[model samples]
Target chain A: MEVRDLNFTYPDGTLALEDVSMDVHAGEIVAIIGPNGAGKTTLLLHLNGTLRGNGVVKICGRRVEEYDVKELVKKVGLVFQDPDDQLFMPTLYDDIAFGPINLGLDEQEVRRRVEEVLSEFRLFEYRDKCPHHLSYGERKKAALAAVLAMKPEILALDEPTANLDPKSVRELITAIKKINEEGVTVIISTHNLEILPQIADRIYLMNKTVLAEGESDKILADVSLLERAGLL
Target chain B: MHQEIDKYAHNSPLCNLDPRMKVISLMTLIFSVVLLPRLELVSFALLFSIALLFVSRLPLRFALHFLKWPFMFITFFLLIMPFSIEGTPVFSVGNVIATYEGLKYGVLIALRASSAVILALIMIATTKFGTLLKALEKLKVPNALIQILMFSYRYSFTFAQEFDRMRLAARARGFNPKTSMRTLRVLGSMAGMLFVKSYERAERVFWAMRARGYDGSVRMLSELKAGRRDWAFACFIIAFAALLHLVGG
Candidate 1:
């Protein structure tokens, strides 16, 4: 996926993004690190057309602007930072089942996908639980499951590691790596520089604009540059 | 947060009763209470005492404090009745007369309302909302309707929380928004934002549903059947209501 030059403003008239541009190659994991109020969320929202902008966004080399949402929604799954926002369904099963159903899959196929992801995430035991009652880690897993159930080719996550315990972070990263290994391109926006060492090969630094993009190691090496861009 | 009524209400034996049976019992009792033009002292005593017995078994006192409002209203109605209606002047006022017809009407309405409210309260006090949905699901209520009710109830708190956060965020941002025009605009924007947010959420939830492969039917786990206890309770309530109406009449 590639963004030419994205621009957006909140309805309250905050100019959130301006001439932001980036590219995510197929089968590659891309990470965007930025500080608060840096238009990270607004940019992330634009990937799935949840938030639209001026310039072009191409998913799988196809212009996201021209792709039908019904088809695009199936190709790129957006996971928000808060599990509460994502996992709004009553049960883990239903939460996971939601995306597949909306895509108009058959019943058996939806159940199969739900069961597959539930077991994959080891959340089979929590199939019947309400998301609100789950522990934060489990809720996050359930939220991911909700998106993953759609079986999107590209997984776009916002702050996947926020508020997670160390073990949960490791587990989440491992699961994400496994999914990446399975050929699902992972695009995540987070400040966890430590995470770059494990999963991300390339890093994009955004501070109200595209400040830097390169190999992960090179990005991490420039501490002053990172700090200046609100990414350190 | 006020504890959800369902969380505490589901443990009672009354909750385990078949919804059909409970529905039947409620219908019979309400009918008897409403049809008996004169709630004889004995029938009224039986219904009130039976309801109190139910109240003792369920977590109703805390689950539904609103139940007390009816009691107060009933008392107020009874107290004011004899003073308002005109019939044989039972008592003389400075320039008005209080009559026996008012007294009879007031007490009857009070008794009927009390009995019906208590019965309904008992039903709600025992059954959790989730269990009620399960029952409805089993009874073949449209899954879509149950789902809507379930999500609405579940997310109403989230809505309030979001609204509160927005209010605080606005206040901190120096938008005091107290003047009528500003308040109206801000509130209108909030309503619009909330509607958009909720609509978007509904869309996301639909995606979540589709991802789960929900091809429409809501297949719930195996539900408890109308066992002996459910039927027994139903029978006892029906018999009691019939006996009340018969004896009172």
Candidate 2:
């Protein structure tokens, strides 16, 4: 996945992402970090064509604008920040089954995918439970399961560790690592530098623009760099 | 407590009865009561007895309060008697005359409506609102309406919470809703903004739905099926209603 010279602004004329550029190779966990309003989420949305930025954003060498949303959503699964915004079905099973069914997969295939993710996330017990009733951590896992059930090539998450407890964060990191091992390129946006120490192999410093990108140990070690980006 | 008015709030023998059975039986009884053309003491007594027997063990005080509301409704409905179809006069007072047949007609209609109200209240008191919706869904009611009802039930609380938050925010800023027109306008705008925000939220919800794999149809985790008890209860209620309908009609 790659983005070059991408720019975007809100209708009220606030520049969100300015000339942001980055790349995610075949299989690696990339963490995009900055202070609030850093446009990390905007950049992630651009990868899936949810928010179309000005310049080129490519997934597997195919430009984002070239592929339709329905097609793109399958290839580049983007998980939003809010679980409430993601899980809408009455039950866990239905929520997980939605993507495969929409893609016109047969009923048997859809159920298989849902069953697979349920076991993977250890959400098998929550198959019948409403998403709203689940704990925040569980809901996040369920959201991730919904994305994983789609079997996307590239997985992008906004604030993957934002509201999670330590245990849930650990569980999520483990789940993402497994997905990464499956040859899926994973991108996560977060502000917590502590959790990223182990999980995030690559770091992208986004400060209303693509500030810097390199090894996690090198980029996150620079207190001056983080401070300059209002993350201190 | 008024909580007794909600029947499905606890576990009991009556709580386990099929909703369809309760609905059908109550509807039949109510129809039978309505069929009475005059204030027949026997039929009135029978209706009252059935209503009492149905509600007796659950909670009597709550039932009495529940019964009071229907009396007012009966009286209001009776007011239309004079304007309805003219009938044999029972008495005369200057220009106003009381007709026996009209009074009878009014009494019968009032009886039916009150019976319906009582039965419905008892059913509501006994059944949880969520289960009641599920029961309706099982009855092959339109899926669209059932979905709407379910969504509304879930989100109405959210809307209330949002309204409360907006109210508190307004209050913190020293804005009073009742003191002046400007504040009233602000309140109105707040409501408008809430609707807009909820609509926007609905769009976000759609995106969420898309993320999760929501196709056109909304699916439930469990399919509500009538068990043996449901079947037996349904058969008994149907037989009873049939007998009443035939015997009363």
Measured against the true structure, the TM-scores of the candidates, in listed sequence, are 0.74, 0.72
lDDT of 2 by residue, B112-189 (tens): 676666656666667655556556666677878876875665555456767889999989999876788898899899
Clashing residue pairs, backbone N/CA/C < 3 A, model 2 = A98-B213, A99-B213, B6-B125, B7-B125, B7-B126, B8-B126, B8-B127
Model 1: per-residue Cα lDDT over B44-154, one tens digit each = 744664665465376546634756778898899898888898688787667777788988888788877777777776666676555566667776779889778777866
For model 2, what is the alpha-carbon lDDT of residue B122? 61
lDDT, residue A176, candidate 1 = 93
Give the TM-score of chain A, superposed on the true chain A, for all candidates in the order listed.
0.97, 0.98
Local accuracy of candidate 1 as per-residue lDDT tens digits, A75-162:
8888888777677655677667767777777888988999999998999998876776689899888888878888899998999999
lDDT digits (tens) for residues A33-59 of candidate 2:
999999987788788777777999998
Docking category of candidate 1: incorrect
Instruction: Tell me the spans in candidate 1 whose CA falls farther than 4 Å from its real position.
Output: B8-10, B14-57, B60-66, B69-99, B125-128, B134-148, B156-249
Of the true interface contacts, the fraction found in model 1 is 0.19
Best of the candidates, TM-score: 1
